[model samples]
Structure formats: structure tokens, C-alpha cells
Target: MLQYQTIPVTPFQQNCSLVWCDQTRSAAVIDPGGDLPRILAEVKRLDLKLEQIWLTHAHIDHAGGTAELARQLSLPIIGPHKGDQFWIDGLAQQGKMFGFPHAEVFTPTRWLVDGDTVTIGNSTLQVRHCPGHTPGHVVFYSAEAKRAFVGDVLFAGSIGRTDFPQGDHDALIASIRERLWPMGSDTVFVPGHGPESTFGRERRSNPYVADGV
Candidate 1:
């Protein structure tokens, strides 16, 4: 079975996730956006082997600690698509602007695209390129867990801000309606910030992208 824990990090309070397969105890940390001590402590407490670092996008709040974490653990980095290369390159500048710790930029070991799958121990997760918030933005979906880690795409009652460089409001909406909605309303999603919400609930109540909107 696959299980995950969310740890909010950085001033942005990005929802960094620690996902692991219980049977094999293999784990991966998704979006280590600072607060490395806290993230590492949790991994230590769980006694799981942390093998990979997965990213959803390259925003400072979502990927601030990626390079450092990967170097420290000798772990491979994956996902977030190649479209986010520029954002990844600007990590240092982003950190300075955001008043975050010095963030180092690094290349992903595997750049993900729609339909790619990532594995952890005996469990596997489907990856989807649901851009808009950022051109390279992606989401991780665990079929068995019925959960989606959707970065800054869609929130509980709101959606991601498309005001940043390369952000596209129309594209975001289309990604939600076309790519995410098909995942089933029952699948709960963990956003980049705030609380988690189900697609069904968001579809019914989200002011921005409700069914009728």
C-alpha cells in the first residue's frame, strides 16, 4: 500500500509530501521547498529508505530545497517536465527575492511528461503534465491510494495564480477540465498550499472552476 504525509515548508508553506510504500519501505519526498531538517527528520522517524526527490514545478516555494536535498542524499531527481528549465535556472534569484535560504538549481534525472509512471518499492504512480500554473507543471496520481499531488494547479476552493511568468489562466482551466477531471471526482488532491480537497467537491463548489463556471 502507498501512504503519504504532508509537511508544510518555507514561508509559502508549500505542502511537501513524504510518500512511501509500506511493504518495501521505499520512500520519495515530493516538493522539498525548504525546511530540510523537518523533512529529513520525518524520514528518519519513519525509518524508510528515501531514494528519490520528485518535483511538481520549479517555483521557489515548490523546489527551493531540491538541489541541496538531492546532493546530500545522493538521490535522483525526477519530474516537473522540461518546460520548467528556466524556472529551475532562476532558483537562486527566486530565493533571494522571496527571502528564502539560498536555493541551488539542479537538473532533473528524469524529466516527466504526460502518461509517465514513477515507481517506489512495489507501488507505482501515474504522472500527468497538467500545465498552466507553469508550463512544466505536473501532478502525481496514485491509483491505489486514489490521491493526487497537484502542486499549484487547483486548490481547495480556489485555483493557482497564473500571474507569474509563463502562467496561463486559460491553460490552467483546460488542464483541470481535460486532464484532472478525468481522474474521477473521488480522488483527493493535495494542493501546494492550504487544505486538501476532492475533485468532486471542487467541481461542485470551487468559485473559480465550478462545474457551471
Candidate 2:
């Protein structure tokens, strides 16, 4: 079975997830934004054999600690597609702007695409390029677990801000309608900065992309 725990990091309280295969005890940390001590403590408590670092996007709040964390863990960093390279390059500037710790730019060990697959232990996750919140934003979905880790895309009741660089409101909506909806209504998703919710719940009540709203 696959298990995950959400560790809220940074002042933004972004959801950094530790997803692992229970059988193998192999794990990956998704979006280690900040609060490295807290994140590391959690990993220690879980006794998880950390393998790689996964990212959904490159926002300061979602990726601020990625470079440092990867360095400490000596783990591979992956994802967010290559389109987010600009954001990655501006990590230092983004940190200064956001009053966060000095963040360093980095290159992922592997750049993800729409159809990429990520393996953790014996579990595999499908990657969907759901650009909008950011040009290279991606969502990690596990069909076997009926769960997805979505960053700055669809929120509990509201959607991501499309005012940032390369944000596209139309593309966000289409990604939700075309790419995410097909994953099934029962799919539970963990967003970057809020509580988790099911596609069914969001589709029925989300003001931004509700099926009826």
C-alpha cells in the first residue's frame, strides 16, 4: 500500500508531502518549500528511507527549500517540467521578494512532462502537465491510490492565482476540466497550501470549477 503524510512548511504553510511505499519503506518528499528542520524531523520520526525529491512547481513557497533539502539528503530532485526553469532561475530573487530564506536556483535531476511516470519503491505515479498556475506546473497522480498531489492549481473552494508570471486562467480551467476531471470524481487531491479534498467534493462545491457552478 501507499502512504503519505503532509508536512506544512514555510510561512505560507505549503503542504510538503512525504509519499512512500509502506511495504518497502522507500519514500519521496514532494515540495520541500521551507522549515527544513521540521521536515527533517518528520522524516526521521517516520524512519523513511528517502529516495528523491519531487516538485509540482517552482514557486518560492513550493520550492524554496528544494535545493538545500536535496543537498542535505543527497537525493535526486525531479519534476515541475522544464517550463518552470525561469522560476527556478529566479529562486534567489523570489526569496528576497517573499522575505523567505535565501533560496538557490537548481536544475532537476529529471525534468518531467505530461506523460512522465515517477517511481517510488514499488509504487508508480503518473504525471500530468497541468500548466496554468505556472507554465510548468505538474500534478502527480496515483491511480492505484486514487490520490494526487496538485500544487497551486485547484484549491478547496478557490483556484490558484493567475496573476503571476505565465499564469493562464483559461489553461487552468481546461486542465481541471480536461486533464483532472477524467481522473474520476472520487480522486482525493492534496493541494500545496490547504486541506485535501476529493474531486467529487470540489466538482460539486468549488466556486471556480464546480460542475454546476
Candidate 1, residue 156: how far the Cα is off, in Å: 0.3
Q: Top lDDT: which candidate number? A: 1
Model 1 gets an lDDT of: 0.95
Query: For every candidate structure, what is the RMSD over all alpha carbons to the true structure, in angstroms?
Result: 1.1, 1.0
Q: Score every model by TM-score.
A: 0.98, 0.98
How good is model 1 by TM-score?
Answer: 0.98
| Residue 211 lDDT, candidate 1, scale 0-100 | 97
Q: Across residues 1-213, which tens digit of lDDT does each residue of candidate 2 receive?
A: 779999999999999999999999999999999998998898899999999999999999999999998888798999989989999999999999989999989889999999899999999999999999999999999999999999988989988899999999999999899888899999999998889999889989998899952
Count the clashes in each prediction: 0, 0
After superposition on all CA atoms, how large is the RMSD of candidate 2?
Answer: 1.0
Off by over 4 Å in 1: none
